[model samples]
Target: MYELKTKENDSSVIEFIEAVENPKKREDAYKLLDIFTETSGYPAKMWGPSIIGFGKYHYKYPTGHEGDAPLVGFSPRKAKISLYFATGDTKREELLQNLGKHTSGKACVYINKIADIDVDVVKALITQSIEFLKETYPDQPE
Candidate 1:
């Protein structure tokens, strides 16, 4: 099992957001933090070295690869923001069409700035993603 570090020392989520060299990116990150916290009603925490994770879940594959992961989260990368949605089943593609300007991988949505997207639509996406995860992994992370 991969355990997250204690939220006691070095690089707090606020501090990490503040350290973003780009003022715009820093602001956008904070805005995202607000949206995530408000919509999910889950506290945000720093995961690993850089990801700002929201809620959590544990998954087990048929191959027996099991581990905990965030329900929804994002990392402020150098060039773009990487949003994570563990459940990217068929619905994800439909959501993407209405998400404004952005690209996505299997479970990550990449955006240059939040301004380029509709906050409401993003919120809906997050809401739907969380519901999907909860339904799919009912006995997830404790």
Candidate 2:
């Protein structure tokens, strides 16, 4: 059985944000905390050591691998802030097109700062990701 390293923990999100070395990143982390919480309508929870996640859903693959993951989340890294959204969602790709300055990987969108991208787009992404996850994983906890 494979073990998941990034499971949610009881760590304080505020302490994690305060520990961020960069002042601007720390500030932006607070801003994002507000955005994600308000948009997702779920309180922020610490995922692993760095990720601030919202609601969670349990997922199992065809191969029998399964795990619970946040519906939406973000991390204020040294180089850029990484926004976590559902992968393989075409609607996510469409929203990223209008997200302004940002680079994306399989499931994470990297942005230099909050001001560099449109906040409304980020909100939309959060909403879409949650809706998509709930629809995809109908067994998710309420």
Candidate 3:
């Protein structure tokens, strides 16, 4: 039984953001909190120690592994801010074209700060991620 490390917790989302050592990261964290919340129409919650997540879905793999996860999230990290979106959504790749300056990973899209990217594009990414997750996991709670 594998454990999901990024489970949602009752921790203070603001406390985690405030603890970010970089003042700019802290500010960007606040900005992202609002963006994710407003775009996803889900309140932000603390996921694990560092992630601020909005919305949620339950997913089961073909191998029988299953867990609940945020529909979209972000973590303000040391080197850059990590934006979490649905991994394999073609819309993700499409939106990233207009996402301004950012780097992509398996699950996270990294950006230096809010100012470095187009906020509207981030909102689109959030929308697409939620829609993709909901459509893919329609049996799961949205």
Candidate 4:
């Protein structure tokens, strides 16, 4: 019985963003909050201790691993700001090409600051991620 560490919580998203050590990253976190909120049309919520998330979906894998996760989220870390989006969306890779100076992993996109990436592309990615998640996890709640 493996439990997921990053479950949604009632933590204060503003407190998390305001507590970011770096001033620039803190500022960028606010910008991202606005961008993600407006794009996803959902209010921001704290997914874990640090992640500011919008919207959510429940997913169950073939291996019996199932949990609810944010459709889009981000964290302002010390080294880099990590952006969370739905994996397995082909449009993600296509949009990342124009996302500007950023690096991405299978689940997270790392960016130095909001200015380092194109906000429009971020919005598009958020939109695509929500659409993909809705289509993929249609059985989940709205």
Best by lDDT: 2
- Predicted candidate 4 versus true structure: per-residue lDDT over 66-119, tens digit per residue: 998999999999899999988897899999999999998989999998878899
What is each predicted model's overall lDDT from 0 to 1? Answer: 0.84, 0.94, 0.92, 0.91
- lDDT of model 3 at position 74: 96
Q: lDDT per residue, candidate 1, 1-142, as tens digits?
A: 6554522234589989988899899999999999999998898888787889888888778988776778888888899999987555677778888999999887789999998998888888888888999998897655
RMSD per model, one decimal: 2.7, 0.6, 0.9, 0.7
Candidate with the larger lDDT of 1 and 4:
4
Top model by TM-score, which number?
Answer: 2
Instruction: Score every model by TM-score.
Output: 0.90, 0.98, 0.97, 0.97
Q: Give the TM-score of candidate 2.
A: 0.98
Ranking by lDDT: 2, 3, 4, 1
Encode model 3's per-residue lDDT on 55-121: one tens digit a residue: 8899989999999899999999999999999988787999999999999989999999899999999
Sort the predicted structures by TM-score, highest score first: 2, 4, 3, 1
Kindly state the number of residue pairs that clash in model 1. Answer: 0
The candidate, 1 or 3, that scores higher on lDDT is 3
